[model samples]
Target chain A: MRCRAAVAALWMLTVPALGQHQHHHMAPPVSDSLQWRMPPMDMSMPMMPGLEDALPPTQPLLPSMTTPPQARPGEVIPLADGDTLHLTAGPVTRTINGQSLTMYGYNGQYPGPMLEVQQGSTVIVQFHNHLEEPTTVHWHGLRLDSRFDGIAGISQAPVAQGEAFTYELYFPDDGLYWYHPHLREDMQQDLGLYGNIRVHPGGEPEAAPVHLEQLLILDDVLLDKHGLIPWGEEVPTHALMGRFGNVMLTNGVTDFAIDVRPGTAVRFFITNVANARSFNVTFGNLPVKVIASDISRFERQAFAESVPIAPAERYIVDVLFPETGTVAITNSIQAIDHFRGEFYPHVDTLAFVHVQGAEAVPDHRAAFGQARENATVTNDIDAYRSHFDRPPDKELELSVRVQQLPLAIMLSMEIDTLYVPPVEWNDAMPMMNWLSTGAQVTWVLRELSSGLENMDIQWSFTQGDVVKVRLFNNPRSFHPMHHPVHFHGQRFLVLEIDGVRSSNLVWKDTATVPVGSTVDFLVDMSNPGSWMAHCHISEHLQSGMMLGFTVEAQNQPR
Target chain B: MITLLPFLLGGLMMPPTPGVCVWTPEYYQIALLPTRRVPEARQAEGAAHVSFVESPFGIAVTRAGHYRYKLELRVSGLREIEGHSYVAWLATPDLKDYQRLGPMPANNVLSTEVYWNKFIVFITLETAAAPEDASWQGPVVMRGMSRSGLMHTMAGHGPYQQEPCTVYGYY
Candidate 1:
């Protein structure tokens, strides 16, 4: 076992680009031995100085942008079981990468304050909208009433501009959840205005073993020659691909460093909130065990060196630092430049972990085993296993195309254009990005059942119907792209990937469907409401690559 | 650059329908003009198909001079360009004047009113938010002339000044 750990460390140094090749193969088994560690190395990719940052959104900000007050991160008011928490949504001036820019925020914080509560406790949030545009907070990955689901048109009307609305949030399940604006989400969410929520179990065990915990919010911002790229209000900025950020951020800070004892166990609640970019995170010389995915625990923890998290997805992992050194957390993914049909290997450092002390913490040796003895993990196994025998109820295909016509011919065509409505803080010019928004219409999802593509109501299922759906991304497309498919208000089990039935039955709301790949999953349609299933990449969502379906009540006809 | 000129009525190969031709499940091919993206050689190789049907007096009688016909259209591989809209037109064989149909819908099927024989049926990509005019301004994408025949009925002498007399009754 020690020899295998040493070999793994040596392999990390010799074959630096192993991640690019290993993803094509099946995932490795979880290591039982906890000693496989790689030494520190230089955190720079081959193409460092010339990689272009993401361009600004289609529309630039006007000069008369609103600048609201900022909030302290530690100023969250603690609430008892049923108290009401007040939150204000407005603009705030935040400085990132030594530049100050105005962005929309909740309670004046870039990433809004953490709202913690106990399981089964119904809490009320006095959501006040103070921005120039309408906004609503969507509780991502939570099963709640449909009225508070936060979708603009489907769930409920958006909180009107300069108005107040109260949300009655009931937390039935215990896990990590998040909140963000739903209307014009590509603009509001990208420019801050996101936060996390944690629901603790009711019956807490006293004197639980002490372990270091950190909640890392992963995000990025695109900067152009004119400082922070402005958010598009009317038209999506990078419609070909999403507007990806160049500067990496963790917990709203660039230099997110942590000091810990040499041999202590640490748990990280990691969430990816970037608009388009996927964060493939790896800790130098540290092997982490993935304990939970999205909002629930896995049957058994799986150990991996690097894990890729897509937009609006969450993962909880635990790692024990054995040796004393400074290790950097790095992102190891190749971002495709859709315009030029090129790939840029973006391997950059995100944060640092410092280990100094000598002795291991005495109480945290059995932390991994103690964390899994919860009631939620035991209750979900039988419900998931019962649906493995049923065949898939439907099949769908995800497709994208890039077509080019002469510029003069495109300019001569008559198009039905939709403009951004009037806003005080936005520029008056009717926003138009002909090259990005008009050149190519890519990212389409087709349902074979109805032969309808893009925004078509594909199906209607009754509540409690266990359905298996097969999603295909074949090689016949004009260009290959990865899509993080998300289903609102439902949690599904990933049964198979590329025809390989998964041994681990982890529940996920958003699953990454890679290029030229197929994924089959089982969805227990438990929530009775109109839910949307679409790609989570913000640009693709804006370009009509989405569909909605209703889960009717059990007694009602579909 | 091979330019597709207006196909005169005499060159049509399909025989024209007699009276109130009922539309069927399938559509017959008309003109197939190549757009800027697709060249003449490629379209000739069957890259895409543009077909339509005419059902006279199928829906209603319009305020215009002719009886309203449901002009159904279908295009297999036609795509949506970002800043442009696809517009259909009905024009004379001599390229004299064209009646502007509205912008194409998302489903690629539209019901329009057309009563002219010996006319050309074509589609063009239009600029964003262009005026919904009755004239053709952009280059042609797919063009085909209608199956040629003479009109089945002439103007009737009535109180409505050479208009067809209304025979209102229950079917």
Candidate 2:
């Protein structure tokens, strides 16, 4: 039988056979209907008929969930040329800020471990899934074979419990990248299953003359009065704007502060791993230059006053503290009124840069020497200027809207409901888990021209076609949004904003489309495959805001 | 009758020129109509008609010698609007960054300079107090985009309605 949700079915088979774990099953069994396809990935509980209608103010707590995974510190299994490093995914407990939260990790490390490899070298990882649930490690932002894209159902099946898989990664470009579990990213990633990949250029990897090199895996953990909030058991809730972390964390540390010397340049590798929140990072009056973004260098250095780092985007910047003073690293968020009625401009200290010690020699020149020399490297905008004057081959509009009736209302009043005995709802707080069922939110995206929703193949382009695309966000949407539109297995240049030509062109796989703005890009369809272009915010993807596009290989006789 | 005759005669004298600048209903629909609208309350009170003209044919001009587009509006119930003032702005159809065209003149005929080829003429009712930025805030009263003798060098709908608007020139 052709199952619409082959992914969900494959995920179900990965559940542990232990009888004690059976009670955790909240997901409805796979059905033949098309509606059953594309079930929410983290939904483990079934809905009871009356439970939703009469949303009680409170409910009982669940028995202490399985002992939080024990800690297995990140271990470095060094790999020589043509060698493989063995990695395992399993339950682990990590204590941070005197709070021990049970979560899963790679090699028992909260952020796993950084995989360092030289450019032009190949590294293989033998991944073993030891967790009770299914999971797959997706090499985020890696330009590799589509089969190893790590997307469940589309790229490969979920790695079953006790199953082992191997990923042979070839580093063509030297930059920063990351890895995370593609299955239940909202849940797994939030708990911890993310790490960084640093691909240094070959031949001694001439290091930028910086006093200190810092790689910060920027993430957040939402906590309530009881400490770590209960995981969204049935479905990852906060479906509208995603669950914003009340406790801002960097490298899983609540109090993230770094030491630096005056007049010394510090190279910072920053990646936003939060499921949603976009951080507008700034150092108080510190002179800085953005050297690279998304692992690709900019043609020339651009002064960084404030940089908006959205989820899944990376930036490498060099900062020089002029004087000996503590410069606060703050996230200035403005114009965000999703839950709040008024636009509140807030400056939050995500981390602090305590500048101490004696002034050291600043090497700002060497920091940018490699970048400036290799400016026209692997793939840059200058190489594609020939097609700049040519007309765009395709135009696309990205739009989102809420359905007339809430999905929760429809599911509660209509559709079949599965009843769970009262005891199962308990988990520190019953109402908390129930709230995360994601019944109230039903957001949808469509290719405005075709009017087709989610996963529909909207367009096809031949390989090597220089396609210019105009992606405009619908201003009239019920809830206007800023989308970090990401294209898988492809890179493009942002040509213009609203109609004004951009002065500096940068190659990017993900571009942030502000609300009520049209961004024009020259899409170099060099990678041939069926890829996805969607909002990078985890909740948006879950709400069906993604679509498929194909790049057909040239010279193939069809 | 004497005052309205000059306005009518002025419009009739310059019978909309036929060229790349012709303003048809489709041009308005393509540029602005689908994206903006007058609120239901404003629509129920009275209808507003907005018309515009580009340079070479436009009657509006700036002191700076820039070709200013002429914008004329006949909107009722402005006198009834209290505690707030209506302001006009030029913005892209998506309503991104906008250029304030100043408050609506009591007489309603206004002229302002614009840069983009595809843009919407918007009138927003703002608080009586001064605004922080020149951009539009509060509810939109009327919205529209104009096509005139000026070159429409922006993206437009393709020959096939189903196709993406990849063509970025005058049809």
Candidate 3:
């Protein structure tokens, strides 16, 4: 215990220093000049630069002066024909890199369709199951009636092949949400039964100076020589890792290009729909002002050097193209080349910003002032900090590890039909099972009973006792799992990572836990109810890498 | 280019081992039998059908006809991606087919077993004849699908294709 304490103290000393070094290296220098002048001409615009010379310099596809259509409340817009969405689900022929192949799609599109609605409005969607087998649609992250959540057997009956189901969903809050299948999620979601849903707040006039608002749904797919790979055909063993695709796509298109005029302030609502992969996205070297998150608008605007979005997460970033010739929104995280276990050199160009037409307004400096002030302040860090700092009665240490076995031995075990290997990794093993399950390998969450039948634990705490939890990722094992740890109903203050504390930690519901690293956070369990804590990776939770604790009033439910 | 080497090589380095028949009934037969019971020596004789196909990836076993059954081409010594690594029910109109179920509820059988970066393929049929028991009819086959510009690199090498097979039962 003394040695452990000593080690902890040493970590406390070293981590902060390392964090200081990283902060210095990563954080951009703040320009003290509050003049808000247009960036120098030669400074190279951040989002899309020098795209004017790349194109044939042709006339812009859409007029630059065109304004985006505004949406208002009490609008009963018909999203689909009745409650049933007549969607065509089948293989579509498409050519990628000069090779023609068939890929599965819904409504003849890779990403089904975009469903737009107003907050507090009722959404009645009639869906037709066109696939050969039965399936259902789940509105991810939407707080709706349990029956409309679309879980086969759990919430509602599965829409049989050639059958249809109508879902009546009421959007309680205004924000970004998504939809996909809840059953055979690994297969169906990967097979392209996914779409984006945006709910605009009711009774509010649209913010002015918002030239264009674009929905960017980021998805990663593993394509075969034919086109998009089909799911459910091959049954893999590893369920923890979920599925990883080779191709990264935005709005269902690869090598996509978006044309815009210089000095245009655009709203880019980015959503990560990948099954397992997390994206670190950058719009070339441009500055981005993040306005909102998954569920609601931020108290203040935050700047992102590079936005890291995990699955089922959303970030709305406002970026003004300084002098966009052409800028590339690229995936900054390097891909993992399977063979060498090393990083791969691939720059997936997600989108292109093509600036066309002569300068709309000379001296783009005026554009900043002309832009309406955001009702919310830009740099109110305290408001962001207040969202966290909740206290919890109980604290737990969660770890993720993988178990490795020889290929021949593992195959023999399955053929012999001897013993069923444990789904999750616990105290015994460390490697995750990506190959067998076609999901990431085994990950176990310990500090609980084995059977999990009677998981009733009482966590006692006062009204203001700051609950601190130290999360550790064992480095002594192979295939350290990156858990996007999340807490339900409330947010917390991220105190430290790898023992180093960060005062600049942003408020988030999900925080990525790197391999062989440790993160600490403080939470106030003021919300008296049973809350769940687990990795955001859906596969991990499906494979039993999850746990929950209940917070009660001092003399409440025993 | 420099970082992609390991991933490319990882795909290439995976060893291709052929499948082996771990359990084959001695006297299994695919024909209509006089009685359900059979002599010990010919345990598999009255069985509707029995056939196995071997490939570099693994072996596939299938039994069809009045009673339908399908077994995946699986490798034993391997572990599953998540949960227990065993033969699961892929797709069954009825939920109560498999003896023991996994984390997911019994009714939905989209996938049976998960293997090394690949999932096992199996399906059973539900008919009035075997209302309680899941059975299948006709020919049982296993196949692989690929898409264009998509590479299936194993152990860090090329997107190699696996040979598909159709298993038959001789009465």
Candidate 4:
């Protein structure tokens, strides 16, 4: 422990002390509730010729914008088969943590109304962009047509200001999916403009004994006493580690609470909609059975104490509450404390489940105790296994490159290279991350086979082709941070990690490739359309770290 | 350049339904008949038709990936014994490992669906309580192989690489 502590001390001392002239040092404690690890902005000396050291979020908003009316919680709107709905994006005023703040919303709510549709049914959404800038709603995890996939520059152009676009969406798979802005997700999605889509089986609900269900959209907002710490007007500022929010929100609100009956099985459809932060969700550290992944149910259910969810990823877990006892639904993880020179447990209370009632009428506790064997997912993925052992058809390495970042930031990153954790639980260097804008930092997705980076690489495949792709998070880069990679029009199986084959498989559209880890997946090119794959970190995506691909239609018979 | 115009809905096809799975079953074929143990090894006279069913939603009509395979067989001239029952079994194409799929629910019909990729389906005559260990302890009665199971010709590898028989051995 002493040796490990010394090593952590070396990482904590990222900046050298060139004597008060210009040095990056950990500031004194800002607040008793939250400890800030950023360099001291008020420390007389500047961070080696940087603009001004930094702006701490604890400061009050100098010019506070008028908070609109208090926004209401997002509503659930269920649409029938072939229903047409109009979705408008506009500004909504919300009181976050006793401070009135302004954020974007769809249909005048913080989170757009949850749209519940049936499987295999087509619904029309006439989306009107009421915001100031252009935006396109990318259905996060759907196998819809290329046009309705909502990706700007690929399927269709962005909905310009005062323009409207109609989306004919079909929910091919019945599970939890979300929609957010594909253009400028760093600003649009971070300030709201996201919602859930729950597609149920067309016929009827399954016999799975789940009683009550909860849709928990997990998000985090970077806010200070002065309201939302301003977004970068130039380029995405937090491109280094993306924006790790200080305040965690559940369903776009703080102190969220739910009432549940004891001895009843509740299925929680949890989605991590945060711009950067990945959550390790735990319901008071109790056991929960993971039923479904992003696209569909897992071949085998996993019983886990916590679920690690990356950005843009969704997981469905069923929890059977005991007789009584309030359970705090939380995201608990170990965050690195550079100031204290150690790691500390950080638990954010996202919500609470008040379980104080009699057992449910039709108690599904017995059936919830057992997991089902799904033949469908197994058979669906059978074809992809053939390419599992062969050499990967394509390989991409994830890393960050900088052209002209400030000296202080570069010095700190170079020194801290000695110890970079597998998963960055917290923004250890918030000042450096906040200053590393898109102009200087370039998060790259380089194809190893062709030596092409980002947009320069174009991967093409035929429909029904099972393509194997390897994602390696190169640890030798300037700064290696875990990235949640998302593919637009395909569902993939996490085939293996590093060299070990993954025995438990689940179909997913987004997965977190941890720092220095190697992930191999098989993309089922069943959807024919121009698609894109990129890091889901909103700011990282803004830093030109994305690639486009094509899945040509099987225009002929096999 | 990316396509800017909306895709034609008519051009889109309704693909296979994304099926439900919480656990996977080993791909095995039940191809057995008890007549081999009898004098002269009598031939079992029966025919079965196996088809794929869509996930509970019944979405797939033209596409065929996500399917739960079902076999329906009606064999004539089957003698029923007092202490024995007809059981359906799934076995590796080589007839080595076996999994008991319980006794025929009703009549002389084996009405059930399986998810095995390539395996032989066979029937067996076992005591009322079939063996639990997937061991071959009963008399083989009938054997039927799927088209995918035929990927492996009796001649080893035979230039096909035999992936259909090897890689899909998912339990």
Per TM-score, the best of the predicted structures is 4
Q: Model 1: runs farther than 4 Å from truth? A: A1-66, A74-78, A202-210, A334-345, A358-360, A363-379, A401-435, A438-442, A554-558, B1-171
Model 4: residues >4 Å from true position, as ranges?
A: A1-69, A203-207, A339-341, A556-558, B1-171
Interface Cα root-mean-square deviation for all models: 28.8, 21.9, 25.0, 24.3
lDDT of 4 by residue, A1-558 (tens): 999988756744442212232333244345543233342232311133343444332222111244545667889989998999899887778878998777888998867889999898889999999787889999888998889888888889999989999998988888899999898788789888899999997653433767789999999988755456666665776788888888889998898898878886889999999889978788885777878889978877767667778889998889888778899987777666432223456788899999887777686777887877667778777867778889888888888889777665665565455345556767876666776777878999988768899999888998988888888777667888888889888899887655546666778999877665677878889899898999999989999889999999988432
Question: DockQ for each candidate?
Answer: 0.01, 0.03, 0.03, 0.01
For A107-216, candidate 1 gives per-residue lDDT tens digits of 88857888788877888889999888888988888777667888888888888878888887877666677888877677788878889887765754212334687788
Model 2: runs farther than 4 Å from truth?
A: A1-64, A68-80, A203-208, A335-340, A362-374, A377-379, A389-391, A401-442, A553-558, B1-171
- Candidate 3 vs candidate 4: which has greater lDDT? 4
TM-score of model number 4: 0.70
Model 3, span A441-508: residue lDDT tens: 44555443232311233344453345776555442233345676666443455555543445333334
Judged by whole-model lDDT over C-alpha atoms, candidate 2 comes out at 0.57
TM-score of each: 0.62, 0.64, 0.53, 0.70
Q: What value of lDDT does candidate 4 attain over all alpha carbons?
A: 0.70
* Best of the two (1, 4) by lDDT: 4
